[model samples]
Target: MKSLMPYLKARTVEELWEYHTKLMQSYGFDRLIYAYTCFQSAQSLTNPEDALILTNYPSEYIEAYIGHGLFRDAPMMKWASRNVGAISWRYMWDDPDNTPLGATRRELMALNKRFGITCGYTISFPMAIKRSAAGIGLVARAGMTQNDVDALWEDKGEELEIINQVAHLAITQLPATGQSRILTPRQSEVLELVADGKSVRDIALLLGRKVATVDKHLRGARESLGVETTAQAVRKASVLNQIFIVDPGTQLS
Candidate 1:
């Protein structure tokens, strides 16, 4: 599989998603879905019953899934929420005690029969430091043999793992409330350094600027971000995910 290290430096969120979608297609899978719970704040107790789903599934299939609330009934949810590995629906649906989703289950089966799809492989990961989870599911069609699964397993395991990590970062940095704000490259840089506990002098030295200049940059960051102190600027930036707070110097390509 191709390395996704370059996407870690992606200048925008759209670029990240584009890179991820391309990576999924490279795995020889017919369909891919990435889903995450929505959050309101760091301290939010419940997720407000909303999620983001990115997939290549046809519009009708998506409509059917949502119309039936399959996300709530999907057997994959049971394993994904608790188990970290891939799960097979055939095994999950076969377990009688589990109470399979009746309508949705039939729909999925019919989908397979109609579209020649057969197996599914799902990988789940924790999204944030808080209570959210993220998952990606790859669907294999009827003609796909063991060799196909093996090929993907061998070639794309690391790629999927890296995608999981990137998804986590994206979720952690996602805004929790209100209208979001955009940050200029310089403002993002200064706030990120501040959040990492860098002093003005050190930031200036590293950025090859005078201390006074760095302080001015910080002031601009504070105003543009609509915060008061440098600490607040840092905190807001972290909350808004305008930049990577942990390693401020890391630049997105």
Candidate 2:
């Protein structure tokens, strides 16, 4: 873990991801899939574009997984959603009568087996804040057994957990990328005023624009953020740091 501190302090997000991948490889995990979400809800998982997802799995496999909606029923995904700790795939699959693997889940497992993803540990990190969670699945090299993975964990579990927790926190601090849309300057201004508790009429008066124009800007902001309401737009914008930045050279009127 000491060897990872320098990488954790890397100046760029890409550098951090690269070094973390190397660290995972040294631990006997040849492939990894890590994902996190800050806006998960009971109704739906956060938009994929808004989440930070990193993996070395084949693109075709991922496309198939998503295209078939397998993630909704994946056994490990279900476990990670509710639990915060390391879980062995063996425990979930080895004793079918006790664990009762469903048909769809069994099929998914079979698909994974074809890619040498038969055994591994999944670490679901404790949430650092409300409404956010992250997890990582470390895939062992082909031919490794459950007992082999268990032994590895017994020797380095504590260090690995710490490394993953740090990685999650670091990822949360980086900016969101590949968003569906970016808020325009006018839209950002409208949302900022809305965040400050200003009403549509107040914003129109303050900005010296027609009430319709103010409403239009607010609507645009909501659309750009992919939210239904202005309040949601404000929350998503704040999360993305789209507003509330204080420029040193520009004075507020």
Residue 194, model 1, lDDT: 80
TM-score of each: 0.57, 0.78
**Candidate 1 — which pairs collide?**
9-253
**Model 2 over residues 1-253: C-alpha lDDT tens digits?**
5575755565445567777878888888888888776677776555655556778789877776655767666667667767799988776554422656687787788878778777889999888567766798888887789799989999998998888788767755554434413788789898899989999999999999999999999888888777899998888787665777544356689
Candidate 2 local lDDT, residue 70: 70
Ten contiguous residues minimizing lDDT sum, candidate 1:
40-49
| lDDT of the candidates, in the order given | 0.62, 0.76
Best by TM-score: 2
| Model 2 ranges off by over 4 Å | 6-8, 39-50, 94-101, 128-131, 178-193, 201-214, 238-253
Q: Number of the top candidate by lDDT? A: 2
In model 1, which runs have C-alpha deviations exceeding 4 angstroms?
38-49, 88-97, 115-117, 127-130, 154-159, 167-253
lDDT at position 44, candidate 1: 32
TM-score of 1: 0.57
